[model samples]
Target: MTASVLLAADNLGVHVGTRALLRDVSFSLRAGEVLTLLGESGAGKSLLAQAVMGNLPAALRASGSVTLDGTTSRADDARARRPRWGRTVALLPQEPSLALDPLMRIAPQLSETHELVRGAAFDQAEAAALHDLEAAGLAASARQYPWQLSGGMAQRAAAAVACAGGARILLADEPTKGLDALWRDHTVAMLQGVQRRGGCVVVITHDLRVAEALGGQLIVLCAGQVVERGDARTVLADPQHAFTRRLVAADPARWPRRAAAPASAGAPVLSAQGLSKGFGGKPLFDGVDLQIRAGDRFVVQGPSGTGKSTLGNVLLGLMPADRGVVRRAEGLHATAFQKLYQDPVASFAPQITLGQSLRDVAARHRCAWPAVLQHLSRMGVPHDLLARRPSQVSGGELQRVALARVLTVQPALVFADEPTSRLDPVSQQEAMAVLLDALDERGAALMLVTHDDDIADAVATQRWRLAAG
Candidate 1:
């Protein structure tokens, strides 16, 4: 690699014992430019970033030459690599909440990081932190704790922290994972801000639209191998590899799938009349009316931090509605109601294996072990995954398992909150098809809550959009 290239990874490879996770990966990123790494799930995108940061999983062994600026650091040099992390290379972590101190406010956390990384005085760090938050479009969230900010706001805060370190090379992972269109656009602009300042950005994402938005060189990886590499427009317009073609064509809007068919109206099977909910003396949504018949795909679409999830809870009687009543069929039992939660890790006990969790669901719903296994198999989940815990498997695999566990109930109505949030594009399409087919076979009514416009359009039989206010 030449001296002009700011960050270069040459022949980088990662292996867990004998199993290769990343093979012969090579790329270079320069200042005032952005590089996009496009790949499906399990393509070692995150692992590559870990290797560059000199901190990978404990089980994995990295073999590669990572050069940041003019200094080269070997992957095994733990001591020598420590000083270069926040000083020369910084990471915009995927989960901001996990990265930040939960007990501290955003300002304090950013200021502390600035003080440590930039060696600034307390007053200087505080001023710089506020400026970074403003640049991140989160000035109002300076005093708010991590728990108080919305998903989009929290992501911006994380970006601000990475930038405040004054590192020349910035790495962002899935920067717009769960954002609405407005927030997604804003985030695009925020990432562009770094480029405007002549810094280098390497973005790791599976979303083709996000890759196109960043307008950079594209490197497509599959099965720990680089399958294609080219300019963004050239690659998207004319993909040479089959895998790249599939990714380019994985457009939910252009997919040949029918919208959820509406059920003929009679007596409403489920009805919410004048539903109102509030938090902290502020009304989230009020005077909302909804009705669901058999086979109804009721989509609750809105921006993040809206009352979509709360509305789902109220309808399921998990939480009380402030000024309304949810009337369901009088004879509906607990078996008739089920929920497919967003975060499967939080849903299951960490100590228990996925096999044990599935067994519990099977017993509660009177489903046979064979039937549960069949459900998991249909969602592209291998049987061996049953022996693993939530942490042992990927978030995508956990999502599929979560779907299978809930489907074993065979409910009359299902509440799916961001069910496909963790899945890659190809897996997302496959998983959604499986979910829709399962629901259709049983004629189950679905109340789906999400911020993705494409997902909202793909599955919505009827749309109920909540206000940001």
Candidate 2:
């Protein structure tokens, strides 16, 4: 197959405050091809995408030539190069929930894109947009608001809008991070269809399974530099760089198994009987029951929009259940959600440091701040990282900080919803190890919500499948 370059980044460099996020990074995407950007958390993967999209923060300074179809321009100039977006390029951000407007219907968004890109009239554009929506697996979601649609459905609608705009290059960041196997597979297939239609796709992801399934050219990044670049199978099966090899080796599926938990246990530390949650007449969880005893790691598995997150919310008292009762130990509970609830830029108080955030949570639970610092160090989070504000830290670092905050609480029961979704394989393994160790030491019970079977198999002492009732 003939290769035609669609986009290229030459010697891309970006600096956020005093920290150099990315430097001397270079890669290219071509029509009829999918290029996978593989990296751990905080490796500047997302920054690279934002830079490409001309959406980098104003505080950060960048120097690079991002070229589209043979036109080279500076970051500012490139952003202003219109007829650029929805025509030459498009972006599908990491979280569909954040990308979509909750109040707007999907069909209108597509129609707007058609009008903006193709100058089509309202009636003509609506018809063309509906056709594109159907092709993108969003036919049923045309009139649905973002909140009314599932994550997968919203993502599909977003892609349809991009397609309708006649974009030739698509950039997707962790597109399937929080989705299940079926949705993950379906999303990838939809992207592949884009490539087949003669467009180029660039996917920034931490999941090796996604890279493997997409069958793309793989480029590995670590600490803001390219470590490996080649065919997906070649790079994964026989990695040349030490970092690449370490990532492949760190897969949770490859972890050594621990002794199984005793089958017969004492009274359950947490229990839910006939839990049901619904919204706007749509039942999220019809009737789900689960039990967790001390030392038990129970995994709740299901596809996206199947109530995995709703179940977590119900457990945390953030959302009330319509029916059934959830009983927990008479103590504090800590949770880490699938999406980063805390603002990446301002999760910490402006006057306080990262260390203070940890200390505050520790003080609330009457725990020692020093002990929390020790745990953070053991988890590979530098002590100095505690001095940085959320705005200054990377996403991975922020997540680690959040995990540290949770640990300081010393809760009797913990609920983690896709805790490793945004983490790289190495960080994922490290975080899981710390969580399991702390739980084991405390003899606390855990209810983990995730779709990654490897994570479920690695950490779960018992497992339950939740389906739409």
Candidate 3:
């Protein structure tokens, strides 16, 4: 007998007026199986996912019927909500910090979400919340607020929320966006747990590592159309579509050649001596020392909650270290320091337009308008997109804009915290190459924090791994 279809979407199309974002997307997902929608940025992966969940934005129009385990709904309903579907469907949203209530503690939040999704008693949900946290690699994050989480931690906690209510059909958008290997493994196990319970999962992701880890039927989308659909191993080993080939090739894991880092020459630009930091009297690292010389690509790597992000802040003088000093040598590149955060949205001003943000950064260094425009053009940002807010742009586009913002400043030291984590492999490769090449041209230093080992291997002249507490 054929596997039962848990969800089916037919002739789905999304458009804003005349422009089509997605068209003719049709797929049926079987229960207990994982179906991954794989594509590059703006390739209509997320749009299709949202369409299936009946969560399209107001301005866009969706023509489709989404059937969930027998109940069907129109895709264009703005009132489409999670609770209305209840345990029949659940979504692990794309941005964890945005998905959560910043004022509430994570424990209570998880319990509440569990109760809402599963229709369980509050007491039972509260008692079982720890298990969800543990599954998401956040046993200690129960009492923490959304603002306190690292990008990776927030992603995991969001996973906990998506799975908390035992929803049989899981719709996750880039669920492993900021996670490291250890936590990523845990997430994979969590998904498997759902499968073991005879549930279905549909994941939208740019990272091939996620697809490989989950072992699913892969559906490749490019420019709003499905180009290829096949078993994971067959398609991954030999993709039938050019877009799929490009995506598969762009993965640093599959890259045959890599650029060699320039020799670490000249005087040390930044030095950390016996640097140690802690929260609530617990030390994250002790007696840690390192020197970043001119042109050195220093890669800091660790699993989730290993204090890698904290280390970046402490080194950049944004936060105080409890035990040591971060020394900087004066008189170098035009701008002394700049950082690209894991989540660029937080770095952007809510009221500021994208163009203004770039110009503001440039003006800080006495940069000219012509130079700013030149940089913006090189980054492939249209003049029209400049007027939009950060929230209006896609994650990949926002990241590229952030890169444009930093490069225009021409800083001597570049600190990139998970710079390309959310980008599709093609975009990730392109963005990192641009950042590294720009740094080289200006004789700058880099302190890159990433969970991607392939990235560290490709870019780092030296590597540092922080131990988990």
Superposition TM-score, candidate 2 onto the true structure: 0.88
lDDT of 1 by residue, 62-181 (tens): 887888887777765555666887778888765565567879999999999889989999999999999888876678678889876655567678777877888888888777776778
| C-alpha lDDT (0 to 100) for residue 120 of candidate 3 | 74
TM-scores, one per candidate: 0.91, 0.88, 0.93
Summed over model 2, clashes come to: 0
Q: Compare candidates 1 and 2 on TM-score and give the better one.
A: 1
Instruction: Give candidate 3's TM-score.
Output: 0.93
Where does candidate 1 clash, by residue pair?
none
Off-target runs (Cα >4 Å) in candidate 1 are 127-143, 265-269
Candidate 3 lDDT trough over 10 residues, lowest sum: 77-86
lDDT of 3 by residue, 344-373 (tens): 788899788998888887787888978877
Model 2: runs farther than 4 Å from truth?
A: 1-4, 76-78, 118-120, 124-164, 264-266, 331-356, 383-394
What lDDT does each candidate get? Answer: 0.80, 0.76, 0.81
How many residue pairs of model 3 clash at the backbone?
0
